[model samples]
Every structure is written in C-alpha cells, then in structure tokens.
Target: MAFAENIKKIFTLPDLRNRILITIGILILIRVFAHIPLPGVDLENLKEFFAKNQIFGLLNMFSGGAMQNFSIIMMGVGPYITASIVMTLLPHVIPQLDALSKEGEAGQRKINQYTRFLTVPLAAFQALAMIKLLSAGGISGQQIITGDFTGGNLIIALITITAGTMLLMWLGEIISENGIGNGVSLIITLGIVAGIPSQVRNTLAVITGEGGVDTGQLLSFVFFA
Candidate 1:
C-alpha cells in the first residue's frame, strides 16, 4: 500500500530514523521515572484514596498512574503547562509582555525563559498543596503520608518533585529540538495512551460486577463515556 511505502521511507532516511529513535528512548525514560515512587508516602492508602475519589482518579489517569504511584514526576509537567498558559495570556494584559510577543523569535525565547522560571515556584506550590491535601486525609480519613508531614520530609519531597518537573520540561525541549512533533503534547499524549489499558480493565470489571464496583456508578461511568 502507498501508506506502507511512506512509512518504510521514513525509516529509510537516517535523520528521521534517528529522531524517531530518540523520541522513543525519551518516552521510555519518562515512563520509567513515573514508576519510581516518592519516599515517605503510604502508597496503599494513596491508591485507595485515588480509587475512591473520582476527581483525583481522573487526574491520576491523565498522569498515566504517576499520581496514584506518588512518583517524583507525579505533577507530570502540569506546572510547566500552567506557567506556559499564564505567559501566553499575560502578553494580552501586560504591555511589556505584549511588546516582547511582537518582536518575533528572540522575544519568544525570552518569554519561554520566563515561563521556565515561573514553573519552579508553581511546581513547589502545587507539590505542597498536594502534600497537605493527602496528609489531611480526604473523604477516606486515612492519611496518605505514613509519618509526620512537616520538616525535612516535606522539604525533600518538594525539592524532588519540583526538580522532576523541571527535568521533564528539559526533556520536552530536547524532543522539540530533535524529534518529530511538539514535545509537551507528545508527553501528555503518551501519558493518556499509557493509561488506556488499566482504564479498559477497570471498565470491564465494572461491567462484570467485579471489584465490588457499584451498578449505579457503572451506569454513571457509561453515561460519561
């Protein structure tokens, strides 16, 4: 088929092949990072909380189970995304940003630099909020953190998560420079796709009356689907 020939041609070109390989390698690395849990958290309680809370469950799904695992990259480039959105909108409200936006590539780079800087504090804030929320105990009344939530543990977790976000941001930029598509979009897409299998299994369990999934909840899920 013509489509098959085009696909074959893509691999035949050394430059394109290398780019594709690099993208795949980085994606694998990201997924591996997602499995490495952050220290001091009660993973079982965390998983139960996410399972019971629809909102957080959805967020976990979007993060490809990273949130449920409480991984170092649990935030999953979310702060970077927020920072980028803020930067994009600020140009409309702030005269300085508006001027920079009109100056083309160099100006765009400056805005991007600013976005990266903003991501740091945003990530830290979000990390702290999540820590507090989990420690405070959700509807389940079970603390997700096993021990004390303050002091050294809090600081270490905050720094690790913030660093993880920055690392992901850097990886995305690398993909943009060397790979085939928008790096951040690809990372998000990959996360969503990676979550599909578990989602499918859960749906099947609900439909089969397994896992003690309530019939009414299944109906609601079906309606949402």
Candidate 2:
C-alpha cells in the first residue's frame, strides 16, 4: 500500500481513529489555552521579564508559549511535580503516611488523594510566585488584571488558574479512561507532535526556495532516499 493507504488503514481501525482524534483535540486545547493570558500579565512587560531570568528559558520549554503569554496555566505542571516530590518525602517525615503506604491498594489511593489535595495550594503558590516574579521583573500590576490586584481578584485569579490546571489534569484522566493510551503522557506528547507539521512545512519551504538544499544535502537526501 501507498503511504496514504497505510494512514487510511490505521484510521480505519476504530480505536486508532479515536486515539488520533483525542490526541488532536488535546493538542488543540493545549495550544489554545496557553494563549489565554491571566488578567494580570502584561504582554508589554515580557521583554523585561525575559531579560534577567534563566527561568524563562526553562518555562518556555515546559509551558510552550504560556509563560510568554502570562497565561493562567503559566505554572504548567511544575506544582504537580513539586507536590509529587513532597509526597515522596512524606514517608520519611511522617510515620502515619509511611504506615499508610503499607496498606496496599487502599493506601495508594489515599496517597493519590493527598497528592491531589496538596496540588491546589501547590498550584496556587506556584502561580503567585510566577506572577510576582514576572511582575517584579517589570510587569505592571495593571497588566495583571487591568486594575486592582485586590484581595478578591487575587483569590479569584488564583482559583481560576488552579482550576485551569486541575481541569487539564482531569481532561487527561478522561482521555486515559475513554481514549486510547495514557492520557497525561499523550497530552505532553501532543505538544511535540503539534509542532511537527509546521516544522516539516518550513523545512520543505526552505528546501524549495532559491539555492534550496546544496549538492551535499540533495545527494544526502537521495542517498537516504
């Protein structure tokens, strides 16, 4: 079969089709949500924020463009990972948790619940830190929300961001249950896959442009071909 026929055969398998579609949707959501900035991040202030921060480079890789957008999801999964780390240390500090882990499936379930419960504050604090850091870097309070980082807006904003992360986390779970493959892993994979077509197109564009591939590259392409 030709390449298209192979693709058609893959999608014709119902499970594979659903998995592909689910993957596509999650990727779309990731792309779209990351662009939705929190009320407070000043797009104008980014140049200054990036000026002195090593974190921006790291955040860019993890958050894609979310941090640059100052999105509610700008914290990405950093807090979740942190919470997991803390949970790992819990057994060493707390005897009760250490005992609980001995309880098997039930214990593991409780641990997961604890991790999730901890994730809220973890996410909130992470969000706050990111906001303050970026703001101090040069973003105006006004840009964070147009006006007033009042007590209410701060809580609301925190809740909004926390909830957004939780929702993404939940969608990942649903995808795992209803869709094929591991949901969380697929969501992460989606980011890399999402960038592929465009990169390929860009490469092709360059290849077809004036001078295009040099003799060596063309020869290499043919050799590999």
Candidate 3:
C-alpha cells in the first residue's frame, strides 16, 4: 500500500532512482574497504580477543567488525565524526569560528575543509592508541598486534589507517553531493546493520547450546530494543 506506492514513486523519479543506486554502490565500496586488512596483525588472535573484551566488542560493532579483522577501514568514520563534533562545538567557544559559520555556504565550505584537515591527526592518534592497546596484553592477553611499535611497521600502519579514514571521508562527501541520504550517517547506519545477522546467529546459538533458553536475556534484548 502506502509504503509500496512510495517506493514505486521513488523509482519512477529517474534522479531519485539513480541517487539511490549510487548510494548503494558507495556503501558496497565501504564494505569492501572494511575487508582490506592492514599488515602485522594476528587475525586469529584478534578474533579471539574481540570475542572476550566487551569494550573491543563494542568498538568492533561500531567499525562493522573491521577492527576484529584489522582492516584498513578499522577506524571507520570515527575520526571524521570526531572532527565534525569539534567543528560543531568550536563555533560556541571561538568567536572567529562563529563569525565564519555566519558567512553562509562559503563559510560552511571552509569549516568542512577544516574538519577534513583535523580528521587526519585524529585518525593517526587513534590508530596509534589502538595499536598500543591491542599490544599491551589487554586484548585477549595475546599479542594480537605483533609488529614493532617503535619501528617503521607502526608508522606504516598508522599512515595506512589514517589514509583509510580520509578515503572514507572523501567517499562520504561524494555520496552527500551526488547520492541520497546524509552520507556519513548512512555509512554509520550501514555498519551497525551489517553486524545484525551475526548477532542474531549468536543469540540463536546461546539458546540452542548448553546454555539453553534464557528467557530473561531474551526479554532484556526486547526491552533494550
């Protein structure tokens, strides 16, 4: 009915249809990037580590499991998001930034450029911190991060991950300019949705395995949802 008609109407508009297709294509590209792993990672240990740590598990969820895979896109849009937040708050704290924001489209474009520039250092810092955390006997108490932190390997990894974040940010900007939806938000939403099937399977396993049915757990999930 109404939903079907709305969908049909959307497809009937050529521009809208094309935009939707382009968005889907961009999302697929992001997922592909999420599978492209960085070097010097112990994949098996990383997986085991993610399974045991709640904080890492949540981080993996945000990155669409890219962190578990040690993917190049492991940071996802995190640095970009952080940059955006900083920009949003800067206007309140800095009078110059507030004035720049009042300059309309030209002002907004400058602000966006600043955000992009800021994302790089943020991404680098996050990458280094993640490496240190994974290697400091925190993640699964195993050496998931096996590279020499003091050597070129760490530098290379940091550069690769930061570049990955920048690439994702570029893709998101392109999607926002040419495709449907708020591109960055859509990308984040896709990452969250992508992990649902595996979560469902895990829930099923908990019910069918030695634990049997946990009605309280099931109810809590529903309530939380």
Which candidate leads the pack in lDDT? 1
Better structure of 2 and 3 per lDDT: 3
Per-residue lDDT of 115-222 in model 3, one digit per residue for the tens? 999999999999989888888877446667676766787888899999999998888887898998688998888887775554444445556778676564344335
| Candidate 1 Cα lDDT to native | 0.84
- Give each model a TM-score: 0.89, 0.72, 0.86
lDDT per residue for candidate 2 within 11-89, as digits (tens), equals 9899889877986687677778878976654565563343223334334434655666666666666666678789989
CA-only RMSD, every prediction: 2.5, 8.0, 3.2
| Minimal lDDT window, size 10, model 2 | 138-147
Note the clash tally of each candidate: 0, 4, 0
Which ranges of candidate 3 are over 4 A from the true structure?
A: 1-6, 148-150, 200-225
Candidate 3 lDDT (Cα, 0 to 1): 0.81
Ranked by lDDT, top first: 1, 3, 2
Which residue runs of candidate 2 sit more than 4 Å off their true CA positions? 1-6, 138-147, 189-225
lDDT winner between 1 and 2, please give it: 1
